[model samples]
Target: MKVKMILPALTEAISPHWRPIKYSLFPPLGLATIAAFFQLDDEIVIQDEHIEAIDLEDEPDLVVIQVYITSAYRAYELADYYRQRGIYVALGGLHVTALPEEASLHADTIFIGPGEDTWPQFLKHWQVGKPEKVYVSRERSLIDLPKIRRDLIKRHLYLVPNSIVVSRGCPHHCDFCYKESFFKGGKSFYTETVDRALEEIAELPGRHLFFLDDHLFGDTRFASGLFDGMKGMGRVWQAAGTVHAVLQPNLLEKAVESGLRSLFIGFETLNSTNLRQQHKYHNLNRDYTEAIRRLHDLGVMINGSFVFGMDEDDETVFDRTVEWAINNGIETATFHILTPYPGTDLYQRMATENRLTSDNWDLYDTRHVVFQPNKMTAEVLEAGYLCAYRDFYRWNAIFQSVSTKNTWEQKLRHLIYAGAWKKFEFLWDLIIRAEQVNKVLPMLESVLDGFGKKSAIAIIA
Candidate 1:
């Protein structure tokens, strides 16, 4: 059988959220993971529309397209085109799982959740000439699975191609999280065995690994074993974890000892009411400063994440959050406009309250305000969101944030990582366009080494 898998360019190329370096950072590993289920002799090809143009003329035996909210329209058009040609097209991913009924309208079949078990079942029935119209994933497992086809990844095309995901779903579900896209009242959290995770890490050839897991420390035991196993791997890596995880004793030390130089943490709001309102109880009563101090003590440069336009947010929310982050010495920060994704609890509440201003999937990327804000106009929410980024990433703001660091090394690393990442878009765009991202990996690693050199430490008081 001949197969082709495509990840459509998200947010349309012209949308304001579109960033060349963001899309170019990693190849579509999901496609490669699914490709592992196919027969070894089957002809397979994968294309990331962010890296290369789709060949609409190709006629493959099967085509699989991954869809996200921002890429739904592009995915549907491709699905419709291939189906019109009497070709079988399978649609899956977040958007499909969230709105499978709508997705089914464009394809021969739609996968409703993680495709691990469902895809192989589809292959069996397909081989027997009786494939179903829909395949819903009921059992979620990460044990003894087939090797992910990393050989299929185009490493030269990505800046951080060594990305891996050892787990699925986070232990704590925030109201705005996309985990609901896959959960559907089913089990969502699972992890690879520590041995499997370490073995996977050993298979990679680079010194820097990006853990794409929603939360690397979600399973404490699994994380401990994984970190213990990685102690001597000589790797520098980045991953997202919760403030609750950072507050746990020994785990932060183990991760840092295992070469965790950077973390993406969600410090969504400064207000505790917002935490309860969003069911983010893990962050409630936790000293946000203690978490930051611990990570900084271990020399971890943070990419603090904050959401704007929540129920308790007002016109000052953006500036207030940005100022707090700057004062806290957060190396870098990500700001979102608090989108109510279609399948999330946030969406259900908004829908019930008649606050959903638009049902357009494209506007749900968090870069746009898609719902009615309780405290401010949608226009103000959108403007504040943009201003937060501008204010946080400005040269003066970068220098100000670095001052929160205790050591000159930490300060220097903070400035370099945070400034270069957001400020050098032209250089990044050129590097991505030329497909020479691999050339910069060594520089990234050296800079990260500096991030892990903090001279002081702190604990929760």
Candidate 2:
């Protein structure tokens, strides 16, 4: 038997704001993970469209295509092609789970939730016969799962080939969070046993490991045990977590001692009212500035994420958000236009109010305006988003942000890391298109390396 697992290029890839370096940073760990279910004797192929063009000319017994909201159309096109040629096609991922009715139209078998449990079921059915048209996930089991088939990954193609996901979903469901709709049935948040997670870490070959978990600190016991085990691992890592997790006593310390170099925090909106509007209770009343100070004090670089075009946002929101980020000396920032992805409370609310301007999936990339704004027009929102990114990454802005660092090493790291992040896009495009992303890993690691013994004893203040 021959199997082909593909991760189609997501909507962001084709967007005007798309950058090759961003997508080239992580390979499709999801596809490689599910490849674990394939029989050893079966020939397997894994492809990430972000890294390379997919070969639609191939014939395989089973074709598995991971579907994301932006990549839904491309996935459907590929699935239709394979199905027309009498090959079996399976569709699954965040988008498929939320919009199964639409996805079912394109797939011979459509998995309606996380595939950790459903993929094996599909394999069983495929061994004897065709899989059912739909399989909804009713379980959240991450314990002792077969190690992800990392061997199937072309690690050299990705800047962070060591990216991993030890947990699933998040504990707090903001109104706009996709996890709320993705895991509608069973346990929404779960993690692997501490021992198992440590084992995966131990097996990963590198000095840098990125925990791709939505919230690595979701379970205190699991997180502590995992971090304790990693004390001497000599690894520098990164992950995303809520402000609530960062403010938790002792948890942030444990993570730092385990070599957590940078963290992504969703400081979505500054206004507390918008927090209530979006049901982001975790961030409500949390001291955003104090959180930044704590992470800086612990030598953890910050990648603050902000969402714009909320109900309370006005034209000044863009410059205000960017200014706040720079004032706090955030090492990096990600700005979004408050994309209300389908199957979220945000989407339902907008649809109910008849504010959705477009149902075109392509325009839902967050870089585009898909819904009407309250305090400002859609054009104002879109223009503001672009201005935010432009203002934040300017040469002057990088210098301003870097100047806030305490030590020269910290300043240099921020300057190099943040500067190269956006300013060197042309070079990154060249390197990525030429399939030489591996060549740039050492440079990234060097910046991470600067977060060394010095950071442990120093505080920016």
Task: Tell me how far the alpha carbon of residue 297 in candidate 2 is from the true structure, in angstroms, after superposition.
Answer: 1.2
All candidates' lDDT scores? 0.88, 0.88
Deviation from native of the Cα of residue 261 in model 1, angstroms = 0.3
lDDT per residue, candidate 2, 80-146, as tens digits? 9999999989899998988989998988889887888988888888778766889988978987578
Candidate 1 ranges beyond 4 A from true positions: 12-19, 451-461
Per-residue lDDT for 240 in model 1? 96
lDDT of 1: 0.88
- Tell how far residue 107 is off in model 1, in angstroms: 0.6
Candidate 2 clashes: the total is 0
The best candidate by lDDT is 1
**lDDT by residue for model 1 (93-139), tens:** 99999998999999898999898889999999999999999999999
Pairs that clash in candidate 1: none
Model 1 residue 293 CA deviation (Å) reads 0.5
Name the Cα RMSD for model 1: 4.0
Error of 2 at 330 (Å): 0.4
